[model samples]
Target chain A: MNDPAGAPALSEIAIKPLKHVNGAAHRWVAFIVMVAFFALAPTFIYPVFLMKVMCFALFACAFNLLLGYVGLLSFGHAMFLGIAGYAAAYVAKEGLNIEAIRLGTIHIPLNIALPPFTPELAILTGVLAAAILGYVAGLLAIRRQGIYFAMITLALAQMVYFFCLQAPFTGGEDGIQAVPRGKLFGVIDLSDVKAMYATVFVIFIGGFLVIFRIIHSPFGQVMKAIRENEPRATSLGYDTDRYKLIAFVLSATLAGLAGATNALVFQLAALNAVHWTMSGEVVLMTLVGGLGTVFGPVVGVLAVLGMENYLAQLGAWVTIVQGAIFVICVLTFRRGIVGELARWIKKPL
Target chain B: MTDDYVLETRELTKEFKGFVAVNKVNLKVRRGTIHALIGPNGAGKTTCFNLLTQFLPPTRGRIFYKAKEITGSKPSAIARMGLVRSFQISAVFPHLSVLENVRLALQRKRGGSFDFWRSERILNALDDRARELIASVGLSEFEQTIAVELPYGRKRALEIATTLALDPEVMLLDEPTAGMTHEDVGRISALIRRVAQNRTVLMVEHNLSVVADLCDHITVLARGEILAEGDYATVSRNPEVVQAYMGKGYA
Candidate 1:
């Protein structure tokens, strides 16, 4: 037998064999349909609620970047999202004031201060922070494979969570609250619900397009190759570790973008963002939509957030319902909603 | 100082715990010649192949490729230096199409850019070459088929095509015909012969007929050591080679 340990798992096998049928046309149609739906959604659905769903959708897409394409299971991805939220919130509330230090010989007073950063700058800062954190975390985590990789990421994330909990900036239990939405580029006021919703819609669409591009890029092709057969990829002269690390950083950065947007949308950065349960939630969303399917995360986030919104009255029963959905999806529709749809259409989503 | 050889190993050894898998084995493959490493089931052929490819690091030894010491180099770095190896098992990306598989290998030759913003249509430039490779391997008809869905023989053919896409200077084939039908063996033999014309081919093969037909040089190994080394005709007639194959009492 071939290397059984190296072979993908049975569940992973089910997700393989992507079929592309009129791929470009299908993607265009999907994009149009999504934009149309978002355009009309505010008239019937609540704008704030839609913004929340979009935030989670972007988050799930970012998480799927590693799990679906790269075959990495990161149980600690919430740390990126959570850290980004804190960073964005801090920037929005207190702004940035970097004081330059004077060394022994050279006196370099490179002090800079910006009072209350714009929402765009704050989000950019959050994304950059996440990318850096991803580099450090990925450097350590990618040394191992499969379960060990997942464990290392989770442990590191837990460390970050503890840091946030103890750190004075995070406000311990209450978190950084009432963070100002700030102006967009110091021009457009984000205080208006419609304006904020429009910004989120654009961000979601932008993030979604970036992910779609990644899945269809040459780099993405190599990433999938590494996922399918890593040793073979190495033999083909790809430094697969570097590719995986870059992919991890990219995924984390996108997740951070989602988190920063969410913090601005809700005017808060709370412990719930960094909690382990957030990681599980993203996983569930990705799984429900489809592990590797392109539009699966969007469908998944909507389904999950919609259930949470409607089932709010059921209290603890919401968790039970979500669990039931997860079970049903795994047992019957393992390919996920969008995955099954893609399989049926014989096209890559 | 001789540069006639493409690959050479000096006293290459690998140990699992205390047992030696490949012990003090020296090998050399002349430039642009087809060489075969043959041994019985427990003769450490695959282990030796792995050591050369840097898949498994040697316990103690030195490996040289193109007159450069590469014992400590990474598998990927060696591949970049034009020393590539295939697996005993079909190593094609199961989900990618045959064309995409070859194209992906070709993409490595293009450039290393982690640019996620650019569209993959830029890869269409590589499609012509990828198609040529697929056609060379007689897999043009199955270019669009997902690799996992292809028949076992066809999948192996795709693996070869992908490997060839890299245009490797020294191609190491590990049991290219390990689990194939007679027809597949013939086709793959022909493919290997054609691809080896411009490059050095080092193969670990169990089929003696393939070795005799294709190999310009043969090395017979037994009990983690080289037993005979020469052309197939000369090595096949070696008394120890006969004993290694026929067993001591039978010989």
Candidate 2:
């Protein structure tokens, strides 16, 4: 029971706890389902296409971490993806070499000037870079909410895109090309199609799990509370702005992870990565997948990517059809594919 | 009632642009007692609460809790000092399960763990606290119910449980029993009594009988100023209090 001072052991002295909802079981089940789907994805579609789906699926889920869980609708999320892709491509092309020098009397062999371009290192660099950019943007973007929030994020992304266009390192309009897949830890060659497929799948799955863990954590609950009622959360003694900043950074990092993986797979980082259309595309993926459902974005990305691949020749029509889907989903099916399915299943999958 | 004071306001005034919403209102609420603020609509009861909680900056005022000046403090800072106000309408996480809603509030009170890694045991403890509060508020059966799915009365109960989870030293109820069935009103009123025994309570109520039944003291306001302050029986009999409620000239 709480005492007179209003300070009590919240979890320890509480009267009773809720029935345990075995979140671990739910996570394991989801993991199994995702793996099973991935295994079967290549059977019905091109393996490269499947890889692309997984990459965007991870990206959408990351974006959902902010939009769905934290109640932040960031319209400039592509900035993270594109910037990370650029970082990954530039790193791969230059190739890191570590230089070992002998400071003492002992003879040290000559070493490369930078570290090797391993997949893990590339992804790590990408994540860190995205997180830093996200932090800076969140500082500015979090001052407003609702439509203002969306517009500020969009403007910030456009600023980044223009900067990328003029930056010499990004190769301007031509973008980065012939980006090596790079040897994994200087061992496993990613040039092998099957090897590359496995690598991309692992990276996407890893990012997804990281986000899943964040959502289930206590921090995630705080984010949800802030989303539901910010004034209330503030009155409850939380610095809500700080929480939003952290969420933004985390979302950007995961998005960057996905973009980096994509660039490595395709051996190119194109202008599309930094475009506002890319930002819009991810929103659609999250919305179609189910705005807040854990695995909704996976389904959304697969469907959208499939449509794009199959309708390549249609060009402008693809935009029209996608626009129609957005309108239909917003007006009639607000819950989207995963949400409706979750309703049928009676759980927020 | 000198030592009995838990919250006291001295010349608290709130001005919005050029208009004064709450004009120089002085009030004192005893510790562990239910005090009600009653007035005609737009008498500034809500504005007074907002000022005391620091949700709105007071144009001119001083608020003291346990004799410490809290005027012009941030709402969260004030709340952290053991004062919390429940909104007129239900302010809850509707999509979250009833238990999750209460647990989140509790988790916040316990220095919410922002750990993005590791298990959520910190939240598990809050869930335990939430369940207890839910049961105490007669919502044990609806522990897992989504807040949005609950009948109107139950949502009221959930909101109260959440505010209680904040471990407030003084609880401000802004029409806690609003928009409820008579039966539900009785239940919430009973809960209010049980909660008041452990902490000071102040509420804004439109219903005279509800105030008469629950409050030890009632403050009547009209057009941003206190018209009368006394026990319910005394204030109800006051000509000024009657005039304010009846929309007549104050005698």
Candidate 3:
């Protein structure tokens, strides 16, 4: 076997091993189960609370897309979420109306009026705004690595927070309050709680699937490669920075979608949405759910929100309880709830 | 100006602050030959290798691959031109399976679209060729194992397989047989020889025996400069070469 002088014939080599089956089947099964559970949940539980959970769940998933897959810990993701909330609120309230004029002898009274902005259009505008902001922030933030990257993003997010605080359109302390939920595509009235809950659930599932698809795609494989060994990926002819930037922008846009949906559900976009505390909460949710697992974020958001709802009477003890849970998760189950469950099942959840 | 040489460096130098790691040195690796860059520790063999591979920009000098200047190109850009380098440390994607690693390398060769929306099942087309490469590197059994879970020798083998998947015209291996058992070294040396039949190989190897057996030409560096250059027999016989190794307290 250690024949140094003579080259071994390729024919003598052993047969190639069978490819390992991926966890795709398990993931899809889990997704179906979760969707079914949610569909039935509103019948028993409060629809509004469930919608809130779905919103945060989507946010956590978006944040995990970068943290788990790309190995980037963005400490300012709330900026995207908050900014998108503001954008959606503003658009839904103001109704995006563009004036059209014909220059000539006669001016026709034809105004391109798109008044009474729909929920779908507002959400799209919010996502677009988030994408544009992500591009600008990601460009500056990706210049650093590890802690410095975190700090840079945090600093950028703080600047945005202050801008929101001072900006007239944001309404400063009060925020853009009482935003109209409006209609979905100018037909379905979102004012109805059931309709609103259904819309949010659909948005959450759609965003979740997109993230899942991204994680399983070729681009995702390369992103994982970059995460594992960036220099190796670079040597393999991948522009690592470009891939990272793309992941970052995508994560931000999804977070924005979650934020927009949250605004529509609550009928308000406020300072709490854009605050650094919200960013930390998303991280905590993702961590508790499992960093890389597909369904981990959903479970994590549910647990956290469930505790908050149940422990409202406990006052400061809620924070202490959250801290205790985080510590326990880190020490006993470092992989988070879904991660540990996935490990037990011997499948990638 | 000659096309016979696949890679050439002119006055390649790298300085970290005031201390020069790689002094101004010219290296010419002829096409389709196993060229070894051998030297004692701190001889700047790795530094020179890094310079040529675009891992580190040269403080001063120019690099030419196939007579085209690629002095300040990015590592990936250089790799696209069929000049790829393997890391001294096994640089395989740790979490990915061996087959997946090879497929990833092959995907780079294909230069496919950056469509993140498409299913990864599309990459299955490269499986047949990836399996061939794995078998060639004697890693057929470990094709489905995560790269990080493989034993040391197998990890190195997987790294080689991944590198080979690139179909590089000129391959640069940094200490390809470093930290290997005697048997692993022998097998890899033979593998390197087989692989170099059509492609040029520029390697920084510490195992002189492997170099003597596989390399067609050798460049000996000492104190960040070329001490001797020739075939192994010629360079090994040179008193200066012996003295440099002996000065480093090696017999």
Candidate 4:
């Protein structure tokens, strides 16, 4: 294993697909096609379903930034997702509450309220909150590498899960519901379905573009160099740990971006966004789509969400079906759909 | 602490699990000289090399570069100070392209390693010098190939190219010709001599021919202790050197 950060769970050699891939023009063409597809698809598909996929796609890409580029597999990324969603929802709806944080028999009472914010402000608030949390968590987590890194993140996320369950502002099991979409910049009404769809579309494309830019930038080049050979990077005078932390914080901010937008799309924020299972789902999306490729997660979202949509009638069996499909994906296309395709075409997707 | 020598080690020692890999030894390389550390396997030549670079911490020792104590400095910090080393085993970024490997070596001096917003075209500027380095190492044909995909000797050449890209004040070559063919050894020896004109070079080599041909000073180690230190002619004449090195060289 060349990576000093520690070996990945799936040794890169077994799953390494894209080797002779350099598709600059093809990548741009694909991006344009993606923009067109998403813009036109909602006209035919249900708007909310499209919006959900877009949000999750953004979430998966942000998670992929850490896992794919930096080679840091965070198993606890959902805390960022859920925290931003809760923050956005809380800010969107003005509310008051009196509750006590319980520690066995000990209690600390909390009373809080806030004036409602516009949808954009609420989402920005969510993103800012996630960035701070990510910075703190990144500081603690980067001390360990590889599987230990994953485990530490998982442990920290569990703490967040419990906090959401006990926090006064969170509204407990019910979550903050019916968060008013309000208006975008106090003019474009988010209450309208098309307007909300446009907003989610812009956010997703913007994030996806940012991820693409980072992958190609000078900083991103050094980042890939670190992921490939950390000691060698250090030998060339790079502070690799610092780069890892920055990538972590950026990924967290992007995940928060997705979460905040997703909450607005549904007009609700709940524990589902923050659950460990949500973290698992993002991993699955990144893996099945292509662990490192740019477009992998978007296609991955479509597959996962499509399965859920068609299989919802199966109730509890959905988990079994999703698991079985993941097994097949791991067996058949471990490089993922985009990854294998990139290998075949000799172009980076 | 004299300014004459570019690098000096003060009683450098290392132990692993009660086994002394490198015992207390003092070493110095004068400015603009090729120094050789020639020893048989397990004489701790590589361990000594690692200790000087601080890649492996010395269990009990201190290292100085230009009279400044750098005993506990980070490997990257040591690199930034213009003290650079190549690996005993070729250690280029395996997945990175040949152009990329050399460019990365050229990257650190310019700073802004955190410029995520800038275009990658900024790095393309470094590629010309990277190509020149690659060509000097006779790896121009493998310019686009990943370092791992290159043949073993070619990978070593890539490693050398990256090392040269730094243009360091001091160069440490750990078995530079370890995997190369006869012709490559001559080529690399010439390259080393050319690069060593202005800078200091400290090498750990098993090849007696390279040590005799290029080094200005030779230090022979046996059982992690210096057995001889002088010019090649002087060191070769020592009975201990003949017994320790030549006896094992033939074996």
TM-score of chain B of each: 0.97, 0.94, 0.96, 0.94
Higher-ranked by DockQ: 1 or 4? 1
Highest TM-score: give the candidate number: 1
Candidate 4 on A1-349: residue-level lDDT in tens? 4222223322332222223234367777879999999999987898899999999999999988888888888999999999999999988886324466789999888755456888999999999989999999999999898889999999999999999999988989999898999989989998999999999999999999898889778888888887777778888888788998899999999999999999998989899999999999999988888887789899999889988987899998988998998998887777788877776776667
lDDT of 3 at A64: 88
Point out the worst 10-residue segment of candidate 4 chain A by lDDT: A9-18
i-RMSD of model 2 (Å, 1 decimal)? 6.3
| Local error of candidate 4 at residue A325 (angstroms) | 2.9
Q: Per-candidate interface C-alpha RMSD?
A: 3.2, 6.3, 6.5, 4.0
Model 1: per-residue Cα lDDT over B1-106, one tens digit each: 4799889999999999999989999898899999999999889999998999898999999999999999989999999999999999889888777888898899
TM-score of chain A considered alone, across all candidate predictions = 0.92, 0.87, 0.89, 0.89
TM-score comparison, 3 vs 4, better candidate: 3
Instruction: Choose the strongest candidate by DockQ.
Output: 1
Per residue, candidate 2 scores C-alpha lDDT tens digits across B1-251 of 26679899999988888988899988999888889999999999999988888888889979998888898777878888898888887877666778888887787756745777855655665656678999988888988666767898899888889888888989999998788899999999999998888899999998777898999888998999998988988997888777766766655
Considering chain A alone, report the TM-score of candidate 2 relative to the true chain A.
0.87
Runs of candidate 3 with Cα error greater than 4 angstroms are: A1-23, A96-116, B248-251
lDDT-sorted candidate list, best first: 1, 3, 4, 2
List TM-scores for all candidates, in order. Answer: 0.94, 0.89, 0.93, 0.90
Which residue pairs in model 4 clash with each other? Answer: none
Worst 10 residues of 3 chain A by lDDT: A1-10
